[model samples]
Target: MLAANIRTQLEAYLQKLEQPIELAASLDDGAKSAELRELLREIASLSPKITLREDGADARKPSFTVGAAGQAARVAFAGIPMGHEFTSLVLALLQAGGYPPKVDAATIEQIRNLKGELRFETFISLSCHNCPDVVQALNLMAVLNPGVTSTMIDGALFQGEVESRKIMAVPTVFVNGEAFGQGRMTLEEILAKVDTGAAAREAEKIGAKEAFDVLVVGGGPAGAAAAIYAARKGIRTGVVAERFGGQVLDTMGIENLISIPQTDGPKLARALEAHVAEYEVDVMNLQRAEALEPAGDDGLARVKLAGGATLKARTVILATGARWREMNVPGEREYRGAGVAYCPHCDGPLFKGKRVAVIGGGNSGVEAAIDLAGVVAHVTLLEFDGKLRADAVLQAKLKSLPNVSVIVNAQTTEVTGDGGKMSGLVFKDRVSGEEKQLELEGVFVQIGLLPNTDWLKGTVALSPRGEIEVDARGQTSVPGVFAAGDATTTPYKQIVIAMGEGAKASLSAFDHLIRSSAPAAQPEKLAA
Candidate 1:
């Protein structure tokens, strides 16, 4: 069950265990159960402080609990926690064995102070890169607080539960048997949801912060680069991000990042965060900028957050990146997380052996179809154009898939669902002037991206497509304000391009700060 190199590494990791821990497994007479037994045995043999007990009676068979010996287990796994979740399993074992977590002291105390007996179950796919964050977060919470319990359930292994609960997305979280959230969620975001007063307290603390020399909004590659460049100049740099990683978190394989031969989105996002942390940049995560105010008489721009906090800066670089563009057809929003998903890499396993449609014939759509072909029964790729826009190599690979069908000149009309979950997709045959419907269980939208500039509609000068308009120097129409990355009018929305744009925008903002000499405007002179 375990490779030799992996076993050696596991043994090294287990040496960090400070207390005795038990793996209480409840399994039946199945192949998966046998595999789990062998894996547990191999794990137990690595550490003297570890033990395995198979006489368990968990409601979910083939599951195991990890906790200190003689104590009630609070962390469990209902399936093999390998693939992207391998790190999650390692952390769970270490934390259960009295090893400290990487979370901050305040967050640890907050988790321990939670009052209710909250049980969290996270449904995940082994192939999903985003599931580990949620799984590790909940597992840590359970380890810290005796009142909390978290279980990571593999959706592919537990097909019955996935179908019965109508789960069509990865990282779908349920608390005490009710839906809590879906998609990639950070640990702070989860805490904010359960702790009602957390948002208000955070807003108050942020509102009282001092003004910055450079304030970069968004935390994607562009925002991170801008922050790094500004901080390197010895200016007080600050970054306010809604999620920090932006669209990169949803990406999977990446072979064209320049210099680096290959890397995934989540891995690159982590590297970006770590690189930015090396500087003296004040990063405030999970904060959305609602409105931007141009430089007033004080020569300081103001950014108002959704949480009622206002951040002031001498120059503001808007790097708020783009999001997955939706079809905007009927029933799409109604059944977004329920059979309508944007990420095939994350949600494809949930639709195993089911019929699904991939909207658009671009590179993303074709790639998604090719990837889903192995897991799903069939895939219908729809394109609005007469031919596919993907590269020749991708289109050839897509055509080679037997379970995939490509339909050109097809416009997605409406997504049909059965109120609770999606059932089919409606499209129009452009050439024949006829309408058609494909009976499917899932619809993956992969058209493109829409810039996150809705809030700057009236405040900043935007193109017709809603992207921020900027000059060659990354300077926006508003003085002392700049924009970069996918949110601006920069062509080619690639990670490498976004970083270059960000560095340019930060330099432009710095230049604007040093050249301008103006007095603070009166209260009456400000825009309403």
Candidate 2:
């Protein structure tokens, strides 16, 4: 149940309910069901507008639905929505009670105008920080649209269902009984997937926009900094990103951010977004850049998008950041969501009581092994190097775990699976040229990161490793076009470094703009 302070907060929040809400429970004689009943009772006691009923028809026991009184419930939870999902429960209650959500008006109208019925079931682990976004997004859609229904199912609580579906990742979403997507996704991304013509519409709208003074090609720490800095200079700034937070959303704990003692990825990402919002930067989320063109004779650089949209700007900053490096072994891609995972903190709970392997011997790998050892039955860490490259303290902690075993000089050959899910993997002993196999239910890859600069291959100067070549001032080989963050030749891939580089790139772009002989062109204003 909730603590004393949380109860007080919940009581205050319930005051915002504009309509009476009902909590219908489908329960069994299990301990989880008892706990859920207590939680429901506590919630019902907080507000006069709330009612709890034990009679329910859901096939999944220990489940419940929240909706406006006398209305068909569209939002349900098959497990106790605690931990990261606690906020999701609160939001579901409020939204179901006719309390308006914090989404933009355009998005609200789009959800309401959706065509067909959508039944969404999201499987998640309570410990996963990324799960709440997916859960809350679906809940919002269900609340806004009568044709949509969403269910948040705890994979750990429903072990049989998870195993039967061969789900090995948190936040795996199923729509209409078929796999929809897996991983951290925003509401816009989900809408894009379901709305077939959305991309074309967005592309047309974006193509009609005027050129920006400074265009940031990412929305991570670097791109956020660039946008803020450019906007502060009274320039028309814009940001295009696949996701607003980039890889930082997938990150778990971030303790090394200066001045702040501790914070997590999602928390930090939200802060970054809020900070950027303080300026006049136009942030276009869920937009991917496909290609980059240097400044033409008209004094503007062009960035093409995968959705057929092209944006022109006086200056462009490439801060696309990086992504997790995957093991190139066979079956890795096929069983990615089923058994092969990259984020240990997000997917570790799904492999509880099952044997797993952590690939790599670096800090991330050792750290993953140490974390997985606490939840999994056993952890086998395979390192391609001759010795562990983790910090001394991390190595010490990893060595202390009895259930974790380390294998140095081992290269992952192939991820062995049962055609549907991963059952094990094969590795080669580099020293002896011998092959070894270990039976495991999950494989957590923690090798390293690959720069997200594949699109800029021949467009910009790049290093041998595919990183954009940037000078001291963050200026790339092309004039008026700069690069920053993990996608560039930055020595360190730290968040702090990326922010500084972004600022520098923006300043350099501004300098380039001022030094040009051509006069600044007045942008065409569009009707709002």
Candidate 3:
């Protein structure tokens, strides 16, 4: 059954609909089908302009074709779209009912002018917060371009297809039957994959020149910030990232970014790219930096990308960022996308009214518990330490929530799950030597972060924990090279902190450029 609050929200959105939308559902006879049909009926009933037709047992599983009256079905939702994906369903209905997309004109133009057929099949879980962004983006693109069509497949219901595709994560997108990317992605990123010719043309333009005044590695918040700051200085700046937004793409709700009260990870990531786009930064996305070579006195620092393209720069700023620490328990890997999730923000909604557990007693774990408590029915936070390590303020906030409970001196022993999905978690009391099992649908692991500095092992001075060693000004051990964000020895790993560090690192790199023997150029004019 739909939550009252969510139903209210959906009704409000439906009231704004100007055109009629037709939803043709192909459902088999089962409890899952019955539930999905009821949910659709509820949604259709809310809006006088919406219509639902039962196609009956035509598909192997529950599927629906959504479009305006007399129009070809341009969008499809396969499986139940609940949890975080409810938003996607609502958005799809809105767009089908004559609501325009919110994409930038540039991206829209790109989509409008796209050639060839693009079939995007996005496999997603109802609980995944990140999946909605990608799904909505692709859905909008499909609406904008006749050449493109997208289907949102519920990974949970379509277990056979999920297994056949070997989808290990939510929001696993396939472009033309090939895996494009897993996790959250922006509209621009999706377009880049569909328009291969455009990407190659852009790459050829960048490959013609190999040197830059400042080359900022990574595309997360720190790297994006660094590239923008460096490019604003009128220098030839370039950025190489396997994907823009780095670890920030995996994040969900960001409330402490200053000024902005609250923003999700995908929105913030798009904003970061939008800000960088205002400048002349040469952004090379989908490129990985395999190795880094320090400048030999007179020569520029060389960065070797996985594509064999070598970028030479007078100054290099490392902002690769970090990844989440895994618990390494049994079934943790077996059921990654199934039930064991590391991001509470992305997957919390999926477990609505269901019991869940949060591992680790740090600020992240406490914050996750506090957040999940609001969305889920109950939250059990397990800490390995004798006492929680989170700040007193956070601890107090977590204590104030009635739905959340904290368990200390407990070590997660195993993530017990059915072959297809997670069922519960097994834990052991460190001191009491007692084992316990918590029946929960989801588990969020917020133990800690591991910096993405493994590739820079011998090239730079790294801390014992593998973070790049940097001074206050963001200067690394090597001259003309700087590091910032979670990848560095920065104490805190907040978004605002990473942005500040990125700016500092860019300024430091600029200072090094001016003091060095490189050609002197006016600050107002960009290097040619």
C-alpha lDDT of all candidate models, in order:
0.92, 0.92, 0.84
* Backbone clash count for every predicted candidate, in the order shown: 3, 0, 2
In model 2, the Cα lDDT at residue 123 comes to 98
Worst-scoring 10-residue span by lDDT in model 3? 519-528
Q: For model 1, how many clashes?
A: 3
The Cα error of candidate 3 at residue 516, in Å, is: 1.1
Q: Model 1: per-residue lDDT, tens digit, 1-528?
A: 788899999999999999999999999999999989988999999999999999989988799999999999999999988899989999999999999998889999999989998999999999999999999999999999999999999999999999899898999999999999999999999999999999999999999998888899999999999999988777788999999889999889889989999999989999999999999899999999999999787777999999999999988999999998999899999999899999999999999999999998888999999999999999999999999999999999998989999999999999998899999989999999899999999999999999999999999999999999999999988988999999999899999999999999998887776577331322232221
TM-scores of all candidate predictions against the true structure: 0.97, 0.97, 0.76
* Global Cα lDDT for candidate 3: 0.84
Candidate 3's TM-score reads: 0.76
Candidate 2, residues 366-473, lDDT tens digits: the string is 999998999999999999989999999999999889999999999999998878999999999999999999999999999999999999888898999899999999
The residue pairs that clash in candidate 3, if any, are: 127-350, 129-346
Model with the higher lDDT, candidate 2 or 3? 2
Which scores higher on TM-score, 1 or 3? 1
Stronger candidate by lDDT (1 vs 3): 1
